[model samples]
Target: MVFPERFSNLPEYAFPRLRKLLDVHQAGGDPINMSIGEPRHPFPEFIGRAISEALEGFGRYPPNEGGEDLRAAIVAWIARRYGVHLNADQHILALNGTREGLFNAALALGVEEKARQKPAVLMPNPFYQVYAVASLAINAEPIYVPATAETGDLPDYVALPAALLDRVTIAYLCSPANPQGAVATEAYWRDLIALAERHDFRIFADECYSEIYRNTPPVGALQVAHDMGADPDRVVVFHSLSKRSNLPGLRSGFAASGSGNIAAMKQLKNYTGAPLPLPLQAAAALAWRDEAHVEENRAIYRRKYQMADEIFGNVAGYQPLEAGFFLWLPVENDEAAALKLWREAGVRCLPGSYLSRAVAGQAIGQDRLRVALVAEEQELQRGLLRLHGCLYQ
Candidate 1:
């Protein structure tokens, strides 16, 4: 049997790699895992009831484009959150999760070739692994631009050479970015959008962390594009109830864009995608329709943000997270630091270098750690204090 070679160069997924690096050593004390970004907060109370109420829908095949009720709820959420109104039927496609939409969208809309050559897909270094996989799946060149401190922890796509930019057909961006937790400002979004317009590429904005912030809600890509009156098809924004509503298990999310893009995505989904089960879609609709639970979840994360800052405040080079639930702490050597923390302190964290790839013989996160703040309040505090004493003190 033969397998595809496109992913042969890709590193192992983060969690598995973490295990391989640390599981060989015995934890020095009680284990505290701060590795993965899975939320520890409570999900909405209504989810179970909502799912039970719609149980009968599972008896029949569900719509691949998402049922009308679910899409309408998503549209309403978008309106309330971003002040942008969209037609549910025309502009929304309820997804199994943002990862599904983000990956499959490439297959649906990625150009077969551009500028008379293989098209290119641009993504920030340390980006969601799906972006690179999707890019390779379509036989497009996956350009990994560094999203390091010098660039404000966001990829500066506009700085690339025009000749290279001309080959771009898709650009993947994540705000309140994972692992690093850097939020992009409106100006950043505006500049990126303008660049996309010039280069004739679409922006796949991953705003799954949009609902969990400390202070001001981060500006959104769809909002910026709408404000600038850019072509609606230029930006397809993917959101999920995973981080937003603490419903990752529900696997509910949606992608919103212009009707033409939705049509193309919907067409592809018709053949290859599994629709979010209708019972779960009902629960997801309820999740999106109500904001009280989201507010409560946000409040919990806000407190955690303060806790992280207070604990790591004086540590040299500690960058306070702007949003999202992970702390990207600088260290001497990422893998070594992670191993030492586990072997000596019983604290497990992801190595930042594992989240990124080497470009031009250099990787951005070679000397950092990605610590997830997704534990119970007391447990999170305990882990942070132990990590501080073991790694910094």
Candidate 2:
């Protein structure tokens, strides 16, 4: 048997790499996991009732483009959250999760070649791993644009040369970005949309963490594009119930774009996608329809954010998270910091370098630790305190 060589250069996924680095050392105390972004908050109590009511639907084949009710619920949620109205049937495609949409959208919409050459996909250097793999899957060049402190913690794709810009097909952006927790501002979205219009590329807006913010709600790319009168298909935004509803196990999400783009993604999905089972879809629909639970969930995360700020306030380079649960704390060496925290304080975190790629022999993430604030309040506090003592002190 032969394995694909394209992915051979990719590092092992973040969590497994964390395990390999720390499993040999016995934790000094009771283990406190602050590594993965899986939410520890309780899901809505009504999810079970919704699932049970729809149990009979499982006997039939699931809808390839999500059930009507689920799509309507998502449509309504978007209107309420982003002030952008979209036709449920034309603009939305429910996903197994946003990861599916994020990866597959490239395949569905990315041009086979541009300017008589292999197209390029641009993503933030420390981006979600799916974007890079998706670019490689299509044999497009994956240009990793760094999202460092200097770039307002966002990738400045417009800064690239005109030669590369002309060849670009897709640009993946994460608002309330993973690892760093930096939210892209409205102006940032407008500038990027203009650049994409000028260069002719699609923007994959990963807004999974849009609801987990501490202050103002982050702006959505679709909303900005609509306001700017950019091409309706210019930005494809992916959202999820995983973070917003604390339902990672359900793996329910949706993509919103122009009717044509939605159709393209739907056509691709029909051949190679697992639609959410009817029961789970029912639960997800209810989750999307209800915002009380989301507000409650957001409140819990807000408390956690305050806790993290209070704990790490004095630590050098601790920028309070703008959104999402992860704290991308700067360190002299990420792997060393993570290992020291695990071995000495029983606090586990993912090394920042694991989430990023090296560029020009310089690893941008080599000096930071991405600590997830997803545990219960007490556990999260203890883990942060211990991490502070072990790494900062």
Candidate 3:
């Protein structure tokens, strides 16, 4: 049998591995799932009407990049949100979801070799899985940089040895990071941009959770790049409607960068991309233009964040999340704590070790559990309380 050895070494994905560990034991009480980050808030009321009006266009092939209205809406939103001006034609390309762009952009931009060695893709140790897979697909060495508590939950790419940095072609960064909710400050972005310029690598900013923060908006990579007058090609950002508009099923997102980067991505997409159905794209366009729904969504997440703080506030190692909804709560052992919570209370949460890899002898995510606060307030409260009782006490 022929098989691709490149992916054979990959661990079984997070959810399936979780099911194997916990499904054999009956949930001790009414099950409350806090494992997945899928948003539970209501999508905007206008989506149905918008989709209905555009239904006829589904009969025709949609544009590979995006229709004019959708592109304009994205550009306008960027201006309003980040205070950066961008040309719709040169700077943006619609994606089925940020995941697609995040994966494909590497293929489009990563060269076969850099500085006489295999190209390297830098990523946080406990990162979104797609980043590693993208690097593997291209045979690039996926360098897992530790983004631990000591590093403020963001990768310190600048500290890498200059020789390794010089071989790098891309670095993936997520702010309001998944699992851990720490955000990158403007100074953080500025330093990173400078580092990328020095090393000659492009920055892939995954800002999917940008809109789900409490209080001040997180600083964006594009804005910082613009402020520093960095080459426009230095940073490419991918954002999603999933977290912002509570539209995970919509599968709508966009990537923005210098024209050269966008053009390269567009060329690749022209051959193999699955453009969103015209009807869905219309709904997404409306979703992007309207800030009212996004604000309401943020308000819902804000209240949840408060509930989480109150429930786990006194627990010894609970880090108050700055943005994003996941609670990366500390534990003596992640897998055992998850099992105890599942067997004693019907609370389902993921063991953080599954999201990270071991380097040397220590796994970065071994002492934590990633709990999603995506349920309604009352249900979320019950889950968190049960988790607190079962794990903390």
RMSD of each: 0.8, 0.9, 0.8
lDDT of 2 by residue, 1-393 (tens): 777887778779988888899999999789999889999899999999999998998898998899999999999999998899999999999999999999999989998899898899999979899999999999898999999988978999878999999999999999989979899989999989999999989999999999999889999999999999999999999999999999999999999999989999999999998899999999999999998998999999899889988888998788988899899898999899888888899988888889999988978788888888889888888888888888777
Residue pairs with clashing backbones, model 3: none
lDDT computed for candidate 2:
0.92
* Candidate 3, 49-168: lDDT as tens digits: 999998998899999898889999999999999999999999999999999999999989999999789999999989999999999998998989988899998899989999999999
Mind giving the per-residue lDDT tens digits that candidate 1 earns over 45-135?
8999998998998898989989998999999999999999999989999899999999999999998999898899999998899999999
Error of 1 at 290 (Å): 0.8
Candidate 3 versus the native: TM-score?
0.99
Extract clashing residue pairs from model 1: none
Score candidate 1 by lDDT: 0.93
Task: List runs of model 1 lying over 4 Å from the truth.
Answer: none
Q: For model 2, state the Cα shift of residue 41 in Å.
A: 0.3
Q: Superposing every Cα of model 2 onto the true structure, what RMSD results? A: 0.9
